[model samples]
Target chain A: MSVLLVLLIVFGIGIVGFFIGRQRASARETGEVKVHSRAYYHGWWVFLVSVLPAVLFIVLWSAGSSIYLERSAQASLPAQTAESAVASRGLALSMVRGIATGLDRLDAQELQNLPQSYADLRSLLGSKGVALASEGQDYMVPIAERWHSQAATARTIGAGLAIALAVAGVIFGLSGIHPRARARNNVERIVLWGLLAASTIAILTTVGIIFSMLFQTINFFSVVSPWNFFFGTVWDPRFADAGSGGSQGQFGLIPLLAGTLYIAFVAMLFAVPVGLFAAIYMAEYATPKVRATVKPLLEILAGIPTIVYGFFALVTVGPFLRDLSAAISGGGGFIMAQSVLTAGLVMGIMLIPFVSSLSDDIITAVPRAMRDGSLGLGATRSETIKRVILPAALPGIVGALLLTASRAIGETMIVVLAAGVAARLTVNPFEAMTTITVKIVNQLTGDLEFNSPQTLVAFALGITLFFLTLAMNIFALYIVRKYREQYE
Target chain B: MNLMTERSLEKAVGDKMNAVASTNKMKGDKVSVFYGAKQALFDVDLDIPEKMVTALIGPSGCGKSTFLRSLNRMNDTIEGCRVTGQITLDGEDIYDPKIDVVELRARVGMVFQKPNPFPKSIYENVAYGPRIHGLAKSRHELDEIVESSLRRASLFEEVKDRLHDAGTGLSGGQQQRLCIARAIAVSPEVILMDEPCSALDPIATAKVEELIDELRQNYTIVIVTHSMQQAARVSQKTAMFHLGNLVEVGETEMMFTTPKEKRTQDYITGRFG
Candidate 1:
């Protein structure tokens, strides 16, 4: 049975069961709140009973049947084709499955009158707007026929078992409805488990991703020594396939690490003061009309896609800096068009909203009482803000800065477009440099195979980047939470 | 019944405590207050005499706090709060356009209902006002001011050891005293307290009441309080207000013992507001 059809069937069963159980509870109810549980609880209890088991069965059946059908189809392929089919069983099974679905689209009369040859069958299916793989041979047609029959059998068995369970569940739900059954408590327990399962899925997926990256990183480390990856000053990933006069593979992370930090530092230096002063002005001095208009306008910078910011830096800021540098030098531009300065400047602009919004909230949260106390002491408004409000808001602002630093460090698109990918270990902001994220993209994009040191190194860089941001987030949260506790 | 209350109020005012009263240090001549378009105080006139504790006692929202805040121009901080008529200190109009509000506040400090200590060390809290107003010539002079303020607020002995401790970490009563010290450090001519004991326990209230008594020797004070007994205990003079009306004013003992206004009598005897 189709998954959507199974869901519809379960919903229909739940509705039927709800009415039956609701009727039973109402028939026996003495007055409102007199029963052990509410009539709605009794109805929900029946709905859960009728839908849950059948849904579980449908999920398990679908999973089990797909694996079983593929294995059986691969087993039944002729010995001559079996050797090749074993190597590409996944692809072949998908093709076989497609043909099986196409057979279903043809009713009994059309299917009986179908051509024996695969090309004729393909043409016939094409006229019906169902295309098969052109490589499907005459011998494979019989296998496709078998696949269709087995799929029908599996659907029948699955639907039969699901309907049987749903019926049994309805009967059991009806029998369980009594005055003292505590249906609400049962429902509550089931709901708790449902929520638990949902949260567990989120946590488990993160763990799963981390573990997968960990194994790949372990593999990459086997080829590249951890010492060289961490402490070496140069970066050059070259192999036989690396066209255009490439150097032999020498993976050094320090240049990328330095570039990342230098860019992030420059971005933060630009962002923090500008953002904080804007926050203070907005929070303390701006009129309500101005604040309401200005805050969203400032935040519109945040909503613009970083990719757009990337090219904006590429086309505009990069060229502007290059020309300005050339004009100052009086001969030629030493500053490259794509340099750390261009990326850092634009990334800082992107992060202004982040810092301002968070710092504004923290500054605004400093109690009115604190301001009042300072003002009542004969301190001017500016004096009060400087002495009391900023001091109180400092910890949360530091947290916001740290979080923004991590965002700058991890950002890929802006770096990729505006900061050229040379991976040079230069401190001068005018020179070209690349970050870990851009190189991670560089190593992994296009038709690269995953097993090589060149490709697997991306995973290693990925885990390193993850840990960097993770450490930043943890430290930021600690400072932020400490600030909150002080206020309380 | 309400007519009789107002009639008695007028008769009592005609026969009230103008005889042998202390000279008024700060006086309001028909001071009326408005917040936006709504009237909060209706042509209310009152006197705060020098070196005396005068308490404004009234039911909530009866404009006594508004009247107290108006004395020091504390209402100036509030948006849309407007005050009319003359409020004078030493016979000079403090609300004159030439009169700086900041200097006025320096001369007349305020303590709020809730204990609002700055998020700083206790020592710094007391020194803040003095330092801001440039009252101290040196660090030693600042230290002496802080010590004297804390001593006068009666918080010195308890907090002498941990003067570096955050003001917020102090107990509720201690925090209130710290605020009082903060107010006192500026050595203002008048201190306007808006229900300083409202958030305190009975013991804290007693400690603060004692502080107020001792403070009356130096600064003139106007206190707005809801407790009638508190008014009876700490005040030398008492004023009664109802529905933004100043119903009566007299010496504290006379007002409690023989209030001529029916509204004052009814309020003191636990009648409805």
Candidate 2:
């Protein structure tokens, strides 16, 4: 039977169960004593009992049987063909299944017109407007035929077993519909498990990602020494991509790590003071009319996409800085359009609304009583802000800054467009450099051998970047929580 | 408590206060206030006596707190609030352009209903006021000022050992007293308290009442309280207000015992607010 028809029948049985259980529960209240549970609860109880077991059986049966059928199809082939087909079993099985479906589409007259031999089956099917990749390789015929028969048998059994289980569940549910039956309690427990499953999926995916990175990082470390990767200064990885038996290149992390920190530091130097002052003016000094007009205008900077910011940096800010540097240095400047200074300044623009808006919210959250106490003591407004307000909001402000720092470190688009991929170790902000993220992107873009150190190194860099951000987020959350406890 | 009926009784008390106007520390002449378009106070004429605790008692939203806040220009912080009147401190018109409000606030301090201690060491919390006003010559003088202020607020003994601890760590009553100490550290002449004991227990309230009695020896105090018994205990003079009108003003004993206005009688005897 078709899947849609089966679904309709299963739901029809659930409706029958619902009515049976509700009527049985109502019948127990013999015109004087009342039923303990509501009629809706009894109906839902019967519906769930009738549908869940049958659905679970169908899902598990389909998943388990498919794998078993694939293996048997492969095993039915001769030894040489099976050996050659092992690496491409999934692809091979999909094509064979497609051919079987095409044959199932034939009518009685069409089947009689086709030749009986396996050799002519391709042209015969082709005449019926079906195509195969390689006209069904020599050993695929027996496997395809067997798969066709096995699939039909599995479908028949799955339908029969699902309907029977649903019927049994319905009978059991109607028998248990007494006044004292705990349908609500059972439903609540199921809901709790459903919520638990939803939250656990996120945590489980994070763990799975970490383990996958850990395995690949271990592989990379086996080939590249930890000492060379951590401490060495030079960064020429072109030799590693020259195929096997070539001299391995230096895998030092210091230069990329330095570029990342330097750009982030410069970005912070620009963002922190500017954002903080803007927050103070908005929170403490601006009139309500002015604040209402200005705050959302400032937040519009946050709503802009970072890719657009990258485009602006690449086309606009970088050239402006380059021309300004030449003018300042009198034509002897070393500044390029794609220097760290260019990237850092533009990245700082992207980060302004982040720092200002978060700090503004944190500052405004400080109690009004603190301000009143200070002002009442004859302190000037500036004095009150500097002494009382900032100190009160310091811990939360620190947490906000650290979170911005993580975002800066993880930032890719601005660095990719504005900062050149030179990977040089230098202190001058006017010089070009590359970050860990930019390097990761550079190594992973093209198709190549997967097992080579060149491709695998992205995973190693990825895990390093991941741990750095994870540590920051944890510390930021800790400080924020501690600050909340003090005031609350 | 009809306005027409209370006006006759208000005149009897007005004739009595007219004889004692010379001893007043602060005077409000025909003070009318508007917050946005709503009139919160009518023409309120009052005399705050020197070196004594005067309590302003009224039901909520009767403009008692509003009247108290206007004395120190604290209401100036609220936007869209306008006051049209002459309020003089020591015979100088405080609203005059030549008079600096910052200096005026230094001479008049306020305490809020809730205890708000700066998230700092107890020593810093008290020293904050004196440091801002440049009242202390050295760190040692500042320490002495902090000690004396805390002693005056009666919190020095409990917090002497933990001077470096955050002021927020204190109990509710102690924190209120700490705020008092912070205010007193500036050595202001007039102290305004808006229901300062409302958030405290009975014992703490009594302790604060005793401290208020002691403070009256040095500074002129104006207290706004909801508890009528509190107004009777802590104040030498009592002012009764009903629906934005000052019904009567007299000695606390006389005001509570033989109030001139029937409205004041109704409010004090729990007939209706």
Global lDDT of each model?
Answer: 0.86, 0.84
The reply for model 2, stretches above 4 Å from the true place, is: A1-58, A82-136, A156-186, A483-485, B1-22, B95-99
Model 2 clash pairs are: none
Off by over 4 Å in 1: A19-41, A74-106, A109-144, A167-188, A239-248, A329-331, B1-21
Model 2, residue A440: displacement in angstroms? Answer: 1.1
Candidate topping DockQ:
2
lDDT digits (tens) for residues B1-273 of candidate 2: 222224324532552454355277899898877899998888889988888788999888898989898898888888899888889999999888898878888899999899889999999999999999999999999999999999999999999999999998998899999999988999998999999999999999989988998898788899999988788777778888777778788876677767888888888877887
- Candidate 2 residue lDDT tens string, A1-488: 65556666777898899988887777776756555677667877887888888888888888887888888876665556446633466666677777677776677676556455545777777777988665356566556766766877898888888888888888888878878788777767877887999999999999999999999888988988878888878777774454765677777889999999899888889989989999999999999999899889999998888788889989998998888888998985667899899889988988888899999999999998888888888888899999999999988899999999998999998999988899899988998999999989888887766777777788888898999989999999999888762653
Error of 1 at B191 (Å): 1.4
Tens-place lDDT digits, model 1, residues A1-488: 66788678878988899998999988879665468988889999999988899999998998899789888888876666546633465666677778878988787798777788889989888988998888776776888888888888898889888888887888899899888889999999999999999999999998998999999999989978999898888788875554333443888999999999999988888988898889999999987789999899999999999999999999999999999989999879988899989999999999999999999998899988788777777788888889889888888889989999999999999999999899998889999899999999899996666787888889989999999999999999998887653653
Q: How well does each candidate superpose onto the true structure, as a TM-score?
A: 0.90, 0.88
TM-score of chain B of each: 0.92, 0.91
lDDT of 1 at A366: 91
DockQ comparisons of all candidates to the true complex:
0.52, 0.58
List, residue by residue over B161-214, the lDDT tens digit for candidate 1: 999989999998999999999999999989999999999999999999999988
